[model samples]
Target: MARRKGNNRKKTFGARDDRNNGEWTEIKKDNEKWETYYKAQKFIPEKDWDFFKKTCQTQLPLTFRITGNRKHANEILDIFKTKHLPQLGNVEFEGEIIKPPVNLPWYPDNLAWQLDVSKTVIRKNEQFSKTQRFLVLETSAGNISRQEAVSMIPPLLLDVEPHHKVLDTCAAPGSKTAQLIESLHSTSDEPTGFVIANDADARRSHMLVHQLKRLNSPNLLVVNHDAQFFPRIQIENNGKKSFVLFDRILCDVPCSGDGTMRKNINVWKDWNTQGGLGLHTVQYNILTRGLKLLKKGGRLVYSTCSLNPVENEAVVAQALRQWGDKIKLVDCSDRLPGLIREKGVSDWLVYDRNMDLKTKENRGDIKESCFPPTKEEAENFHLDRCIRVYQHFQNTGGFFIAVFEKNGETQKDAVVDEPPKEEPNSAIVKKMKTDSGDVVVTKKEKLPRDANEEPFIFIPSVHPELEKCWKFYGVDDKFDKNNCLVRNATGDPTRVVYTVSKSLKNIIESNEDRMKFIYAGVKLFVAQRSDIECPWRVQSESIPIMKHHMNSARVVECTEDALKVLLTHAFPTFDDFKDESLVSKLKELKTGCIFVSIKRNDPLKEDLFLPVWNGSKCANLMVAKDDTHELLYRIFGIETTRNEQKKPQQQDEKKEEGKMTENKI
Candidate 1:
């Protein structure tokens, strides 16, 4: 739909039109204005116009994908198939029998599923409501996420590997970044490949952090940077400073978002033809910058949630024209089986400010940026390589994706001429012009930064305290100490010590002067003054990465009964356990966090390893609250009650109340 340009257009606010109380009547209302716009598009087949319009006006079906790297991924899939699917049966709608929920054909491993019913219908049905509750619980626990089908396509197209350096240029509310993290860790327990998720907005970057924190991967790093001018960091390897290039780059740039009409009802009212035209420059610049950051032969997937060719094809065409032989579109038709998509259009009419088709006489009125390529330019550009996902074709939101492969040699001196300046309040620390005529942008916030500029100090190999921790935990003496770094050089009661990847460590040390580090790696160990037996306590979050490397004395095997007690109680005393053997084993352990294993006798079930802290008189589970609850429910068929859960703040409150009473006396 072509939207006319206007300088003083009235702002449109989205309002719920709940005329019909039973179902989604607001979405079903026919908007002739939007329909007329769709009719003008040449790429959409005339026969499919009716279906496209109807689909755009309907509420999108709820869909979600299972997290690939979670411990309970397979278990959750099994529960959905064997338990949830059976109870769903068949739903009836408008005198028609609708089949049960099915997996999305294009999504890998049959992980993505569609409810195939309206939200109201799911709310009213008892079985559906129960299934919904299960979904909500799993989502809250980060085992699964509710995302659209088309939104999942870009990451799959990127085909990320465990050892490839990756970047998501515009990651925010980071669902795609989470997918990248999952893909990076899908094949390996400890991934060498690192992901740099960046967004222009600082607030959204923090939101990205909160979303990705659930995955708990040490290889992922969050940065706030404008995609149009993302910085290049030099890695210090063997006393040399080398530019960092990504093996895979995802340029999911911001767009008009007209394609998300089914879910975001506000789009229908706020739709403007000028929206795509206005964003074309920014989109092209981001894609171009992403290509510059990409390594030779690296793949960059350029995508948008808008259906407008001006925002999709035109922007990609501009990049191709500028780069020439350095980049080429990769055909992805064979990648996603059963996905319905249209080829990118070579020809599209530009609309003037009055919503009229631009003619030779009025061509100047329309921006040249919105103009389509000539016939010869279109043929050479290979526009057909791009994929356009329409709402009617797959019952999914509209999307555009184009995969570009960097070829031949790397562009060492790649630079944007007369680059646009950042906003006054941007998070950019400084922009410097380099000798190579390239711009280097640095961020303001750095993770794991020392206030006094102290060099990262490694734990000494033969130190008395270090040896004590190694012996107490039964950790191997040969375990690499170089990866571990204390916060300060003096190391006077440091709160936490972090272990970073080899690549990340190089970047951290070399680029300290140029870039701000916000967060780099996972916390390896935390100091515990309460545990005089072992001052250096292992972090629970680091268990997954350190499990295989640890062969320490602190590891113990516990019975199923003991595991159930530990999972249910925040702090369980020796008397809380029913197993005498478990109590005997606990008494022999040091007062610190230790690995506990619960071996299942059933061959079908996998053994579980957990971390718990052994206090002077009691033991505390070091696992996350959601994880503890899930484990308790899975093992003992018992859901923890609010009263039984003891929070650390509650004890502090009781102590404060006692002090208040004493003062009154």
Candidate 2:
């Protein structure tokens, strides 16, 4: 299981030690850096430090095993240490190392200390797989945050068979995706299943990619598009399209993120009544969409990180309202006995009959629950189906989840794809033709060979407002081409086709200018833009573009010289011209290369230094070079036996290979 340290009011588990303590040591090697951070407050006196130090030693790797019968607790603990402990030398209890079990049955034939427990965890004597174990310890910023939402997923889902198709809607910064991969052992086994992780915002899908790389999960296909409008894609591989309907889907929708209060005080500080309401609609939309793709008897889990009633119960209640008896809310309260011990409030504002707190809270600042209901009455409604796990319960982060099954027939009509809209060639033509005055152009001659020779168009520099629109729309396709093609529509040259091309060129150059931005920092959203004139404008046509482009646009790091080669050779496939006419045009134009600038001091990177109350670390580090690796080892208190530092060029390559690449940083 991921380990935990002690807690302090000032030192919330997720608090950044480096940010909180500025004199924090900064150790830089290659492209990566390392620094120490401390959470937990200074509440303990000097004398208590001795005791706390002892606790830290013993509690460092504490795995909280909640047993069905208290009598088995001691026996289980004894067996764990005696039989299993010796073989798993890397595993620890608190901080001290123990020997392998001398007195146990069914010992390792080839055991690897994996922690794959049965679904009935509390009831049996569980064995730890060679893989690491995990627990839902507590909910607070110091322990976990919104970005790590998927970490709360039960490892039991990993029990899924090979070849199964899994869907993770609202999957970004995919911690759960990583977990599923680890369980499936994607690297060694040729599993039959594939994981389709989708999010509404195209940009945020970058998180899933980053985590996938770090977690080294290859069975996943990342899609940067709206999950609600997911294409019913057919995968005809070896002999057939292995999957049509998904066996499992996780709808971890967006919410106010109340569970993140411990890490992000800003949310709680700015909390408003409408906070939950604003996100509930989108959450409902994504969930309903997933339900459509589920096969008969398929299981789906709807979950959220927010504690607010509007986001949690209200959305689920609305879902039940919309589907009638087509779906049944299965009881998942029994899944985590460690978590269920905590009480959850079922008398949410939605159930209030007379003094409806929801209405009162929104209409005005109402203090009391106008429509009060008895505890027994609330219990009868199975409000308990909505699990409310808090941080205090297990020193883990807070999160809520409910499982359901599709019981009856799905929509009889072949699930129809959203109708296609007509293409608007006029708009596309106008945008390329309009003249953009005073547009910034790069004068760097003999530019990096890998850089695109195509006349660059930087969108942000050409028009600040257009750049603002980029964030809203995400990619180049989202622009209103109809407006672009109608040169006279805007009268302004800068808003025309010529200007649009210039804008595109400028964006390419700027990306080159900001070389550091080559890698995505954090994905905030995902979106797509379509051609106005393509005949294949159906959902199928759109899916390929979104999938291929999403994969292609991703930044891959190589040696500086190699990157320069790739950048200088970039070109554009301007849709303005047909392929017959475009053949000669391609030879004359050059490929485009843009530099992405990353902040010198990125907040997300800084956030990693925050103390992890209960955290997991991969032993074989992905570092840039031997020196950088040495530096990290030193911080972790590992002694270095050699002193040979590699050359800068070699170090750079190693750094590219070995460092921890964050989703946002």
Candidate 3:
């Protein structure tokens, strides 16, 4: 159980004492340069300029959204309302009572929360510490993730469904990609839709895998690709190789990040007028490619964390002009009911790198594609459909989101000129030649290596070993074995088996020549060659899916005490059980991993399911270390100390050494 404290303490916000602590003090920087730039720009309304500037200088409030589509979601939310909320009574700022932490109204079901106080204050206050601890624990457990409130807005506006094919072009340190996956799995046990999360940087793409690994959904794939030139993949659907287009695409392109000044304090020192101007070309290219890859009548969302009009409206304007009839801005004003946002700007001056206006006389230095649209063109662009979320209004980080719907016409038929490509060097020019009336361009670079280089080999479900193991374990007949693939093609004694959805499998097999996959699907089983009842063993990570699909013949319903002891030790002998019935039940079972469930006595607590491997002399708990600790504390009134936890592993190591000694003798 989680501990709660400071229920009776009175808390205050914005007090002088709060500011005296260096931790809570906001870093003040010279914003005269930005103020001057904003004064010259007409995009921001003069009336709101002061408020925006003040808010930009202040520290951003802490915010996070509860993860959807998980077993422990409701329980975590309940803990916040019942245990955490009461502890954070009323906050008093300057001797006046202010509202405590509140949920963002526009966020669904009040799942998103905000702490109005600064980070320093939260660490200092006892009540706040309790709330913070809960959030930290839940985040580490993968039940929740910490993200800026405004950052969560784009995926919500996308309106993703369980059956819509989705793509996130610039997903890295993927918080929004996680949201997209959650929304994709919102309504179904198994989502038919799949998300392809791509990033230009290979390191960041791998980092995305680590971030989303906790979700453990099979309907996701991480890839490395430059957003501006993402490859066109072909998937075999209905026995035909058709070009794959996403039903929904997220173009959260890289930006100057001016809007993140509140959180990224270093941006204050690095502010420049030329930053947005320099990134406009790259941003436009990425969005254009995203639109081209979108399916006809599908939706694409373009977003940025920069408040500069050059990166926000100008890029959208350019794409709109190029694909006039094939794309239109989607009106999302009513999408999030209570969200406070400003309408996008249609009028903004274009400046050169030197901060001088680029008129027709001085426009020779500017590329035609980089030029801002004319007055008439801006009107038809429908820039007002875009949303600009300023930091001041909601006390959150700034963001800009614009949704677009592709028309029924194919992008290939649209009379849009492709961007100019760079000239090839002498060596590349020699490789490209006309052969058999087709232009053949030789590959310039070799494909990068991944963690697993073994070819995916499927196991025959009817094989003698697999049949015997399934029957002995009473595996569900409905479980599709065709989707299971072994690591090695040859009959290797010990290898890992993984499962991929049919659609994803088709995508991978068909596009193996074009795209590079970083990671895909979950590990379902690990084969072990031993003198045991079954040759194959189900991995603990696959327990959630297997438990629901497998029969109860191999499951053992253990008492609370027995469950606690099993979780506390690594491999316990028969004498370790307090109940003789449990020991007898275990002795009769085959030598393999079996499911163990604890009967729930508390209405608030959920039953615990774990896996334990039975050996001739002792049994080993196959659950993760963190999970073991959590279950022991939650199910039984037991807290495992670090020393107690290490004993089990040390004992197992000694036992292995003793076996080696006996073998030598």
Candidate 4:
């Protein structure tokens, strides 16, 4: 495709997609300004420039990760290795070898995987359907996350602990946010630390709720706010109100996205210096606010998908120059061991939209901070500590990551950090940039507040419904009664009773009126028939939590075959189960909710806990239809039980995934 001449916002371009016999559209693979701008920086080796561009034009491989609890992730991994990998190995269709999915070496424990095939081939070919079904179902079940390979890097380096309060300033379409939540619950059923996933867009923040819903994390709280001016939240500290600071913060700010050209091909036509230059101030401000809200000695990562120096190194240089050594780029070269990356460029030139070197005369909207730092300034900053992931290095998208530690890690209890002294909702004083490029501390202006959130009403511990579930489900003293709450204006638990982490409970109770609460908690119970003694049914998402609380009396032993029949048939008669003892146990139980414990096996691997509804003569599987379909296919080698004719496969696949939460890990 040739560049269009004249008048495209002062210029024009040609990336005409010419087609022949429905063959791949031949999009021109080159852009002049994009090439010239990066060539001047010399970030890549001269010998690899052509190779880098070549790789950028190529399609990005499909990548995903097995998500949820550590042990659950292992179970999924075992199935993938034993079942999927062998079948996918060197698969062929019409004389072409479909490369098998490979484990991402740098990602821990081979949980992350990459497949080198086009979406067209995967969806259209009959040979890959089983694998595709497996991916689709598990993804629907929330046991798997189909995330980009490079997109998984920042959270890994964040090194979040179960007790650290973490924040994602720009979380949206939240794959990375999902990883952070998994890390928080890695070893414990209930993590002390909670996650705050905030996006500037209101709609995107709600969309985040859907993506993160798979994890069923009671610890996550989604909020919609401009990241650059995210409000300072207050939490009850020793019975006194105080501002809360985060221990781990991710600043994956908005960028030019040129590095995504391998998949987002429009960058070929849209690439320009203005894109990198235009968003610099906003990006810098977001990072600065993230730092301000980070606890001392806490970790905060600043990253962008673009490889532009103005957006990457120049921003880092400016921050380092402002804070001096107070905040330093953390050396992460030893982490993510197999990850290929380059050192941050210490020197680079800026450019204007006209493809000319940006200077005082023509650098409109370009901040002075966009300029390369002096040699002395660069030396002090030690900019080499930043990590740059190139497209050619590991067949991944371009990324720039700079991890920072404020002052140095504040020590807490194997517990959480005590935030520095600050006032709640009291005009947060932070750094800002003047139009002329001078830095000054100023009181932030009032941001738009939200009054639309439903109240999170905690149910009383001694309520009749609570007492009934306590007796019937065997919920013990170990479970905190205060964690159970409902969302509505009337403060009534008319339907679902959800569970939240103690940390989130604190934030919500302290700041409910001031903050925007999009979604939180795992479904502990849903309204059931009043005819039963226990008027609440256990949610599949809450099984992990309920597992520890329920005693042996509430469990019924089941096998893979029994589970298969129960899942596929929806409701199976008591006599349908082969085990006489299982039937006797169900017969003994009240006609309400029950637990079926699948003992450790070769295929299922670990003990699996499932919720069920016991009737007088039959037992109904509590799992959702989509989740049931996934289990049948992935565990029993059976395709969907419901006929494909009933609904279009695309429509079926596109509907919301089952209620699998990240807690499966």
**Per-residue accuracy of model 4 over 453-495 as CA lDDT, tens digit each:** 5556666566666767877888888888778888765556788
lDDT of 2 by residue, 1-665 (tens): 11233445354432445444444432211110000000121223455544433332221122222221122223333334554465555434445443332221111111112232233331232233321221221111111112232244533432444556677777777766544544444223334465666666655766566656433233455554566666554434445433257778888887777566544444434545456556767777777877788877778878887656666665666566567678877776555333333333454443221323354446444322222234554544455565665444333345767676888755551175742422322211223221355543223221232232222222223443333333322345533222121112233323222222222222222333221111111111111112111111111111212222222221122222221222221111222123433224333322211111122132322111100000011111112233232222322223222343322232333244232222101
Shift of residue 453 alpha carbon in model 1, Å: 16
lDDT of 1 at 278: 78
Q: Estimate each model's TM-score.
A: 0.83, 0.43, 0.81, 0.85
Which tens-of-lDDT digit does each residue in 1-665 have in candidate 3? 11222445443222223334434443455555666776787556799887888888887888888875544566667767886787677755446554578889999987888887867666766677656766765675666788899999999989999998999999998999999989987876478899999999989988999999887777788888888888886688778777778899999999989889887776776777678877889999899988878888899999999888888988898889888978999999888888999999887666676667776456756655455577898779888999998888889888999999988666473323433333433322212222223333322221334646444444456655566667777888776665665554243325567776667877776655567678777777666645566766777656656676778566888888887677766666777888887788788887666778776776665566677776656666776565565455434535454334524534654385332221110
For model 3 the local lDDT of residue 656 reads 50
Q: Write the per-residue lDDT of candidate 1 for residues 1-665, one digit (tens) a residue.
A: 12332436552243223333423333334545455655787567898787887888887888899875544577678778876898887666557665588899998878899887777767777777767767876786677888888999999999999999999999998989999998998988678889988898877877887888777777877776778888786786667667888899999999988789887877877677777767888999899889888888899999999988889988989888888888899988898898989899887766654466775456775557567787888889999999999999878899999999988554553443432333333234333333335444333233444354434434444445555555667666445555665655454326777777667766665554444444556677777654267677777667767777778657787889888777765556777888887777788876667778888875555577787766555676666666666666556655454234534333433343332221110
Q: What is residue 318's positional error in candidate 2, in angstroms?
A: 1.6
| True-vs-predicted CA distance for residue 131, candidate 2, Å | 18
Residue 287 lDDT (model 4): 88
Give the distance in Å from residue 619's predicted Cα in candidate 1 to where it truly belongs: 3.2
Model 4 steric clash total: 14
Off by over 4 Å in 1: 1-12, 15-33, 70-72, 91-99, 118-124, 359-362, 365-369, 410-471, 477-480, 484-493, 529-531, 569-580, 601-606, 616-618, 636-665
Q: C-alpha displacement of 612 in model 3, angstroms?
A: 2.7
Tell how far residue 107 is off in model 3, in angstroms: 1.3
Residue 601, candidate 4: C-alpha displacement in angstroms: 3.5
| Candidate 3 colliding pairs | 12-92
